[model samples]
Target: MIVLLGITLAVVILVVVTWMLLTRRLREKYAALWLVIALAVLVLGIFPQLLETLTGIFGVQVPANLLFSMAIVLLLGVSLHLSWELSQAEDEIRRAAEEVAILRAQVERIERAISSGKASGVEDADGVG
Candidate 1:
């Protein structure tokens, strides 16, 4: 009963991750990571003793401890990746804002020149005025 439940849960997770990828709700890289994780879960479910062997190989006393440690590391890595992406987005936004300010200043200058030229009755078509 427990083995069947574990397999079903892993399959469900795999389906959900694939659906998210197809719907464009998740990025390809993240989807790939999830797919790998789901596959690992499926393998672990099919052969529960694999986890025990892994724990022993890694010098861990309990399989649950190794699993929790891996989960924590994965979460930390994901958090770091998101932070880096946010920093890049912020840098891009700053550059875009600077460009907008420069363009706004140019537009304001052009408007002032046009108004002054009209008032002084010295309209130059080439804008040499």
Candidate 2:
């Protein structure tokens, strides 16, 4: 019964992840990781012995502890990647904002110069004023 439930959940996750990838809601790189995880879950559900073998090889007392440790590690890696991406995006935004401010200042200066020129009638059609 538990195996059936796990298989069902794994299939649901697989379908959802595939849909997200197809809709461009998730990037291919991230989708690849999610697909791998879902497939791993499905395989483990189908063959419960694999986990037992792994636990035995690793000298783990319980399979659940090994699974939990792996999950925690994967989550930590994902969190770190997300943090780095966010930092890069923030830097890009800051640089863009600074460039915009500089451009705006230049525009304001040009406008002021144009207004002053018109007021002083310093620009003449004859090319001399």
By TM-score, the best candidate is 2
Tens-place lDDT per residue, model 2, 20-103, is 988999999888889998999999999989999999999999999999998999999999988998999999999999999999
For candidate 2, the TM-score is 0.88
Model 1 error, position 97 (Å): 1.3
Model 2 per-residue lDDT at 40: 90
Model 1 C-alpha lDDT versus the unseen true structure? 0.90
Question: What's the alpha carbon RMSD for model 1?
Answer: 2.8
Task: Write one digit per residue (lDDT tens) for candidate 1, span 1-129.
Answer: 777887998899899998998899998988888888788888989999998999999999999999899889988988999899899999999999999999999999999988998889785887664
The residue-level lDDT of candidate 2 at 90 comes to: 100
Q: Worst 10-residue stretch by lDDT in candidate 2?
A: 120-129
Where does the lowest 10-residue lDDT sum fall in candidate 1? 120-129
